[model samples]
Target: MPKKRGKKYTEAAKKVEAALAANGDGGLAPEEACKIVKATSTSKFDATVEAHIRLGVDPRHAEQMVRGSVVLPNGTGKKVRVAVFATGDKVREAQDAG
Candidate 1:
């Protein structure tokens, strides 16, 4: 026998299904996706948005592996602090840059 979802789980599933129905299972523009996410958020705290991408490269072969980093256009919603250890010119450059 299959287990049944509780009332809360069922209600949440309905909400998700409704959202999916309203927004068809097609590729959405970034702005449109953000709007949908914000409208559906039911928490007092800010919600997190994530993306999962599948690349056409083989990971087993070291030569075919890919690595890179990107800076988000709007910046991540987190604070970062920089710490540097240096002497003379490097220390002066860091202090001046700050």
Candidate 2:
């Protein structure tokens, strides 16, 4: 139990604390507190750190995704190719957007 808690919590706590503090004062009312946090903490990505925890992934995996190495793992069995299709003018947009 200690091993599980130690490995998971140690990696997650600092980032979570910083994110919460950046969101708003932790003492505020629940609804108001959540609203401030949500409004302040928007990322362009569809997924978020909290969602990863709710989905039961280890925080180390989350850190890898944040650091961009998770998407490009050399040891993964399959190589992935991403495709984008658009009108003639949108090719540059696709690359820029990624």
Candidate 3:
């Protein structure tokens, strides 16, 4: 068996292990995992959860590579502005918006 950790570390580890076991052998679905993460979080402020995906494409091969951009249905939390170059009405609209 491994040596015992400090009190805080031991408590944190127990919470993590309990969370994992609560999900069971077949494993938790994405939504279930998110719930468990939220429930187990100790932060005072709201925490954002993210998932990382690894694709099976080889970066060395140009044909196997994928590149694209997507606009989220709900925009990012940060504020953004668009710049336009035009004459007359369009310019007036852009200036007013800016």
Candidate 4:
């Protein structure tokens, strides 16, 4: 099969790319990125980016954080567990299907 080219980079993604490039070899670490995100980006979703950036998290890490939190392969460091509550049947269905 022919390898397909990826979709065109998004304008926002381009901006991020340029910003990183401009920072050069000693570019922004995750923590620094998060700080910049916190200082500039103002949407609710951006907060996750900010936190990741501040923690020196990588782009993929930032993406995962924004996508939604998840358990790590190693699992939570503790043996404790918690229950999740759903507000409605739809949410329950989504949880089950997911």
Candidate 5:
């Protein structure tokens, strides 16, 4: 069984649907989506943003497995420096990404 949502959730869902319709198939820009989310927020506590991705891969097959990571633009509150060690092609790829 699934839990029922409250009025706030329903309103936010409607706003999301409207934004999707206005943006058409291309979808909303990252900035626009953020604006909509912030505007529709009804909770007093801080809200979190996340992503759910689907890919074609078999977990049992090592060669076909996929893995990746992303860095948040707002960052974690602490300040820190990051380091990466790579060899050959990866070194070049990291440099290019930088």
Candidate 6:
């Protein structure tokens, strides 16, 4: 059986839906959406945010794959986690460098 959503989860979903409805344009500003995400997050860890855009390409066709990134002149302030994978003395170097 699938797990059921809790009261808090249900309330958060409803809140987000209402907020979206209030935006008659059917779109939320990036800042406003971020606020809602932060407000409705009940996890102990930081919430993960993802955005989807349609490019009108069939993903099943490898030739139509789209992948690239544009770095902003001013870096985003989001925290990033780095991993140091080494099997030998390099591990010690990573720790010392940190």
Candidate 4 lDDT over residue span 30-85, tens digit each: 76676555555535573443132344556566464534587789886788654666
Comparing 3 and 6 on lDDT, the stronger one: 6
Query: Which candidate number maximizes TM-score?
Result: 6
Off by over 4 Å in 6: 1-4, 53-98
Clashes of 6: 0
* Candidate number that wins on TM-score, 1 or 5: 5
- 1-98 per-residue lDDT for model 5 (tens digits): 87899988988999999999998984777788889989898879998878544465788999988778979798877977667799999998888877
- Higher-TM-score candidate of 3 and 6: 6
Model 1 spans > 4 angstroms off: 1-12, 18-36, 73-98
TM-score to native of every candidate shown? 0.41, 0.21, 0.47, 0.28, 0.48, 0.50
Local error of candidate 1 at residue 28 (angstroms): 7.8
With candidate 5 superimposed using the best TM-score fit, by how many Å does residue 22's alpha carbon deviate from the native? 0.7
Candidate 1 local lDDT, 1-98, one digit each (tens): 97987775676667656766777864555676566667666678977779655576899999998999999998988888899999989999999888
How many clashes in each structure?
0, 0, 0, 7, 0, 0
What would the per-residue lDDT of candidate 3 be over residues 1-98, giving only the tens digit for each residue? 98966776677667767867886763556776676677667679987878755576898999998899999897888888676879989888888788
Stretches > 4 Å off in candidate 5: 1-4, 52-98
lDDT of each: 0.75, 0.57, 0.75, 0.60, 0.83, 0.87
In model 6, the Cα lDDT at residue 72 comes to 79
Number of the top lDDT candidate: 6
Clashes of 1: 0
Q: What is candidate 2's TM-score against the reference?
A: 0.21
Ranking by TM-score: 6, 5, 3, 1, 4, 2
- Tens-digit lDDT track for model 6 on 1-98? 97899999999999899999999876787888888999998999866689754567997999998889999786898877779998799999989988
lDDT of 2 at 55: 38
